[model samples]
Target: MRSPASLVLLALPFTLAVPAPAAGNLGSATTQNGLTAGGCKAMTVIFARGTTEQGNVGSLSGPPWFAAMSKAVGAQNLAVQGVDYPADIPGFLAGGDKKGSAKMAQLVMQAMTACPDTAVVMGGYSQGAQLVHNAAAMLPADMAAKVSSAVLFGDPMNGKPVAGVPAGKTKVICHQGDLICAGTSTILMPHLTYSQNAGEAAQFAATAAGM
Candidate 1:
């Protein structure tokens, strides 16, 4: 358990930055072409941003996660992509953006097919985590097997396992007081600081990817 002092410290950033900045802080709005055009790297991360967050990959968790992952396994080996989808609140209310989730699944297939040997890491934060779950559900069992690891933060569907992906390959990180993980829509202090978990998530992804 985190001490009270730690809790206060974690809450500071969110307290000041109520609505975080856009993808420019971390990534861009689209990577549909980026991944397909570049061929393949040693690894690929297919990420989705949260509701109301700017760009395809939000500023909060995506950048920090990618940076840490690159450090864990050389940057030369890593290629990142964000699932382009309308990340509005309504989409989250509807159990993640259906089209967005489909797009994510499509991206996964593209990765597995184009570079079957490339290590694949799937991830998302908050509503993005919902996309991960929805996307995995769309993949065939054989295709899903190629995904090396998946990491979700502030997941609304916390208790459930990622569909078709083995339990061991997935890690859902929900802060102690995150209401979203409890199946509520209310955003709390815990949900906003998932970037702090980047290192731990990156290590898990790296180990799972065998990098």
Candidate 2:
């Protein structure tokens, strides 16, 4: 059998012919660089991807920001885990296909359990940004308090009232014209890009994680 990523390609052509499913699952798929061999605990950065994006929580190309942030995080000797979830259009509106928000809470709990002293810095883009907020809100107070920082870009719920990390620890970055967070859907261009702010975001996260 082919890999799940490859299988997506086989199903792509038919996706247009037939309706697509809600992309994938609500599992905690983490991609990191510097974890010690026997799961030694280290400072951690958790990233969540936007709609339709695949692989790790962050992409390596197109928008270089994610990759840039990954590089910076590695420089800090911290591990990065890109979270996985159903980020499809429908799934996002329906609050994820298998309780994506709930799974993220569990993911956080598991991470803390596995690496007790690990400092967690998290972020997400677009729909993934919304996921970050939802996940943060769902976590138990003690667990949520352990999170060092949360950075969100183009979150649909940016300006709205939502549960999330503490105000001081949370940073919401919305471009002037990005309507998703700004509530202006008429313009579709600005919402598609955010590479310029990736480095600054990474730096902030690194500092918050004490790296």
Show how many residue pairs clash in every candidate, following the order shown. 1, 0
Residue runs of model 2 more than 4 Å from their true location after superposition:
1-41, 58-66, 70-76, 95-98, 160-164, 184-187
Q: TM-scores of the models, in the given order? A: 0.86, 0.72
Give Cα distance to truth, residue 125, candidate 1, Å.
0.7
Clashing pairs in 2: none
Cα-based lDDT for every prediction: 0.81, 0.59
- How close to the true structure is residue 73 of candidate 1, measured as C-alpha lDDT? 93
The per-residue C-alpha lDDT of model 1 at residue 15 equals 39
- What would the C-alpha RMSD of candidate 2 be, to one decimal place? 8.4
Off by over 4 Å in 1: 1-34
CA RMSD of each candidate after superposition? 6.0, 8.4
Best by lDDT: 1
lDDT per residue (tens digit) for residues 1-211 in model 2:
1133422443234323422223222122223332322353456656666656655453411134444555666634555555657666555454333466666667677778888888776667766776777888788888888888888877767765335466767777777776556642222446655666777877777677766
